[model samples]
Target: MKNHRKGHLINKGNAPYVLLAPTILIFVLFMIYPIIRSLYLSFFELKSGCYQFVGLHNYIVLFHDRTFYKSLFNTVVYLVIQVPVMILLALAIAVLIEEKFLRGKAFFRTSVFLPSITALVAYALVFKVLLNGDHGLINYVIELFGAKGVNWFYGEWSARIAIIMAITWRWTGYNMIILLAGIQSIPDSLQEAARIDGATARQRFVYITVPMVKQIILFCTITSTIGTLQLFDEPFILTSGGPNNATITMGEYLYDNGFRYLKFGYASAIGYVMTIIIFLLSALQFKATAKGDTD
Candidate 1:
């Protein structure tokens, strides 16, 4: 009976693994295989359907590549500036909309979220027209206000600004929805108790509400960090990494290397570098948040 019972427990333990066999097989076939293949490719020099084992050459070239550095710098700049701005704006908006005193909350939420759901190509084209240097709607409006119309896409900084604006407009509302869910999950009794204790609105928020929602805020921070790190579509579609590569991001650079220039090995090295950077940054963010929570 003891041996039979032991065998039964062993079978029970193995049941989950047996059930998950297909999923594991698929993951090995799709994700694991590609990752291993890419790593192998990164170590080679490929030309004309022939390859040489030129280990670290692609990585060395990437280090000396000015375009790669420029794209890296631009990506870091966007992550630093845009992530905090969008997260803060979203938090504020979420708090406001979740307030009981706010009227027509549904309408307001929907309106704000509309931009996020809009097709990227459609919005990019619309913004291009609106921000046209001379005849664009925005420039025309600025002229009406007795201000000089600026060329948005012609200058490096101006082109980056356009990319930032487009990303912020599209994503802020999605962040707001996440924060709104966090806000709503807080117990109303806590707020009532604080109010009864003569806490001002600001004090209640700073002391109670913010502390309670700290985990959700950390979640948003990490997700936003990852998204900003992988940023590609907006910059690619809107600016095309112009004028003179000022707005180039890692993803765009990777695409250019792989598809346009046919430097597959070099592109794979870029991909590996990007993966490492993203991992380090995300780990740092997680550590900071965890430390803050502990303190």
Candidate 2:
């Protein structure tokens, strides 16, 4: 009877489902459930230890909130200024590292990549000290050049610049590694062909190398855009979104609303708003890249 039962279980039509049950359950509980729950919560307001349905109240208030607008603006500034610079820097490094005549290739590659693996909080703290207004190393160096030390955290643009620098330092290497892999995959024959055709190095890079790695570049841009949109830790730890909140991002504002103020419903509304923005931006990027490919 036991042997017959075991054979029947193994041959059952629903056996595949039985094997997948745990994974499905986990996905529902963690992923799907949270999404649905947040959407539900976004329409409500937390009052007196309970949720009260408030329709569009949270979103309406959010639209009217000046700080939220400031945070959004700051986030846009970072996305605009940081993404291009980082991508270009990464591409440059990747090209340099791929040079056959370059010495210390392994050392240079490892040095460039090490920053990306550094702990987020640790790097933020290091930058904070380095950029300190009073006696930071950066200021010390400026003083050596007979210039006054500028307070990085005090001036609004200076503070934003500090955050931008920190983020660039941390992530540039990561994108470089990705771009390097894409560059490595290119056929050596293409380069030789371009050279034989009397193409200059810059022309070869612009016409052949860039076009070959177009898809990889698109991928990096999309990811960098998403990462910039979700930026939180650097501003939170380094600047604390200070200097009149010039460095505050959507993620930091969301954190403040949800955890700091206990306004869970409002925070959920903010999250949904961010979700919509991310979705729209991603769609626009896809359309733009698709159009580029056609062109």
Give all candidates' CA lDDT scores. Answer: 0.90, 0.94
lDDT per residue (tens digit) for residues 34-83 in model 1: 89988999999877789889999999999999999999999998999999
Regions of candidate 1 where Cα sits further than 4 Å from its true position? 1-26
Q: What is the Cα root-mean-square deviation between model 2 and the actual structure?
A: 1.8
Deviation of model 1 at 20, angstroms: 5.5
Clash number for candidate 1: 0
Candidate 2 lDDT for residue 238: 85
Q: Clashing residue pairs in candidate 1, if any?
A: none
Cα lDDT for residue 109, model 1?
A: 95
Cα lDDT of candidate 1 equals 0.90
